[model samples]
Target chain A: MNRKVTPAALALAFSTAVTLAASPALAAGDKDKGDKEKCYGVALAGKNDCKAGPGTTCSGSSNRDYQGNAWKYVPKGTCKEIPSPTSPTGKGQLQPFQEKG
Target chain B: MRGGGAGAGLSERLRGAGGLTVEERWAVALLDPEAPTPPDLTSWNGSDPGQRFAVYRNNVVVSLVESLAQTFPVTCELVGEEFFRAMGREFVRARPPRSTLLARYGEGFAEFVDGFPPAASVPYLADMARLEMHCLAALHAADADPAAPQVLEAALREPECLPALRLRLHPSLRCLRSEFAVFSLWDAHRGELEISQVNPLAAECGWILRSGLEVRLLPMCAGDCDFVEALARGNSFGEAAEAAAGDREFDLGRCLATLLRWGMVTSVNGIK
Candidate 1:
């Protein structure tokens, strides 16, 4: 399949593409508002106050075992939004969304 | 959950073993929950420094986990809050940030998810993580101006120079090819489509770039993906076209239209 597209063919295709690309009709996909609205609360995660060190006043606490390897939890987020291939009814049969404890 | 005393014991063991500084020991104890509060640590409240250290340790780990959750919300959403936090906690403990650039933290998380055991059920979770990371990177990538329409129009005048003309894409442009319908899954999350309507097994090539103030995900055929990647690698128009044409479904005109319309082409070079 080494048959190269001739120079004429390449030129024709590229010119046609350039013309089409210039049309405003093709720009309909540009929908994102460029604002942080979607990433609002999420972006705040890393921007926490840069305290000199961890302060005793910062009351965040999570005591779960870090190294323990056990798989009792299953995906129950938007994954539930997808229909399971295994479901006999062809509906979303995944578990209910498990709220944070 | 070993106490601050265990940390002190480990600190002593390390000191006996030799060569560690007080600061290094303090850093290690802060991230490791089982490690005791550093012996040198003192509290202002006159309460036990060990208990205070425990609070500090928890805060440090929680903040890092929170960062991971923020950067990979889709990953968090896919696994649910509890599982994601648990997995994030494990990740935070295993791999702490090396640089103070918190925004760039968790760059390796996608790869980490690929090898993680608990995430094995959602086979596409790793790819989803990768897509999320790419989106964030694109969002923060340096800005560049797209080639003006006149530049491309002028280049079109010299048909013979087409093969030599190289297109420069925007700095934020990122393309990814995934075996899973990762683009669809992301699109589903973005509210463009219902998640249940997507087939997770469908292979897709994702095109991402921050055009103007907005980051956009453009749908691409396999040919378009290969074409853009070639151009991004500095291939000329003819070379990229040839590569793209290898796919039977290649449509050069449509692909070019998409790139130009999205403001992806920053410059058209080597055209005399």
Candidate 2:
């Protein structure tokens, strides 16, 4: 009980404690559940069971293994899956790509 | 307790006031807006007026030329570095920066390049500069949401029966079609590709769009290129697409996928 704690050990223990305490709060502060899911959705889509990163959540896209995670501060409607060869087709009408001015 | 009150030395009194003489004030304003114009050259700590003026002049010239260099990289590349620096120096002396933002400093440089005698060998260099400026502007243009694919899908379902369908484009999309392969040249230069392997004669219609955090360049087909040009002119999606599809190579499916992938489509508004 009287053993001395070295400065390095104390620092490491302090950081670990801080991380453990802060993880839940950080997760809760991430407001958009959809974005969190989408950010880690890529991993989910690949059928790999991965823990959601801090401030992110994972959700399933139309593809079973494909998951999407959205970040908290990213505005709504900003996050979309990167178009790959296997991405879905024929859901909506064909529209011309709008060029931003 | 201060005895030398009235004439505590003119220098000390003037120093306290921090006032500048007319000539010094004029020189400082001419050199830099922020510089304090001191009253007399005799009062200056070390440098004489001529020396100070030379330093200021050099700084102003160098800064102006640097701004031009950023605005016209292709023009510089074509002329070679040493020649470009000389040309830039001449340009700075002829026309100084009028605005604080260096980005807008070279609005007239394309015309300047066009008229320069030495640059005559490469007639298309000026056009290349113009195209680069457009790309720069487009890359920094305002951000907008791509139109929801669901809404566009609905519109396409009733293509024949639909009224006006207005399409909103992302703010950062731009296209430039040119007879020369200026796009390819720019691409090679920007991407740091080997210039020897590139064919300057190859023509390309370049489209630029920002997806997520990065800006990308797309090679446009004849019909899609025409369609984007029409949209830029404020044509409705239906109109622009029809004009585009009039070309035999226009494939609706391919265009839609490209648009979606690029995050170029913003909103589809159907007429009430």
Candidate 3:
């Protein structure tokens, strides 16, 4: 039972698809539940969500293992759980941390 | 490494150690109004290298000022053109770009505006610069496919499980909280919608998120902003909810639904 898509519905679907398919990598999303997060000092280099800091000419150009300024979208609970070798305390921090390495 | 090391050693001997590297002297010469070109300008083919360097200086200053104008169009519009260029000249002199990327060069420009005594009359100028610069950053940030609405719905349907699962935000999502109306100020500065009207005194909270082709500077409240920041920091649903709780009525369900519809959420978990 396939009816022809109305222009309204067609446009809606097209827009939705376009919206979803835009940027293929990096960055964090936010909604009210407070469940989602962008944790800094946790992203792997070249895999940072965004904000790689000064001297980084490109989006994902994190220099070290866990550059403090680079962020990754992680679950809120997982932020502290994830281990950062360079972190001052060797643990994830809420704010950007000065890395050892 | 060999070529770079050799070049550095020669440059040091030519320009003297701890004085100014060849490139540093060139940059300094570019800013100087005097037409006397540094000996480092030997690469230039012109007979009058000093004159040529002056021409190059003018070109560099123009280009840098133009880039600043583009990055902070509103600030340019707010301050007269002559005045803006003067300010741009100072900014260039003080904080030259360390990297080749022009887009990311002016990260400190907003802070510069905040401390600028000339712009003291318009204190919100700094926040406006911050917003505009953020908009630029959002444009270049990595993108992501938001989680399907159904996935979010399913998570919401099970309130208990929601606390355990992590949500990922879209790569282009950027949030700003300011003591000034950033969005409307940005709106007023747009070329097509040039309606120069906004309240400078009122505090504002805003989020910049990109859809398919469009980037939105949407107004949000502090409560919701806190909620989003918490989540972005890797807070769990329950923890975020508690942190987001305040005098304001934070409709978690509706807000989450809007974010899903807008394609701001990347996934229900790290699976994405």
Per-candidate RMSD vs. true structure? 11.3, 22.0, 18.7
* Model 3 lDDT per residue over B95-210, tens place: 87889997677779898888789989887888888887887787777868767656654554454464555767887777798988767777776643445457767788878877
C-alpha lDDT of all candidate models, in order: 0.70, 0.56, 0.68
> Candidate 1 DockQ score?
0.25
Clashing pairs in 1: B4-B36, B4-B37, B7-B36
| Candidate 2 residue-wise lDDT at B192 | 55
TM-score of 3: 0.66
DockQ of each: 0.25, 0.01, 0.02
B130, model 1: CA deviation in Å? 0.2
Candidate 1 runs further than 4 Å off? A1-3, A28-101, B1-18
**Sort by TM-score, best first: what order?**
1, 3, 2
User: Which candidate ranks first by DockQ, i.e. highest?
Assistant: 1
Ranking by lDDT: 1, 3, 2
> By the DockQ metric, which is better: model 1 or model 2?
1
Please tell me which model should have the higher DockQ, number 1 or number 3.
1
lDDT of each residue in B27-131, candidate 1, tens digit only: 888888887667656667779888888888999999999888877877888889999999888888788999998777888888888999999999889988888
**Candidate 3: where is the Cα deviation over 4 Å?**
A1-101, B1-12, B34-36, B43-46, B191-197, B247-249, B270-272
Model 3 lDDT, residue B272, Cα: 27
DockQ of model 2 vs. true complex: 0.01
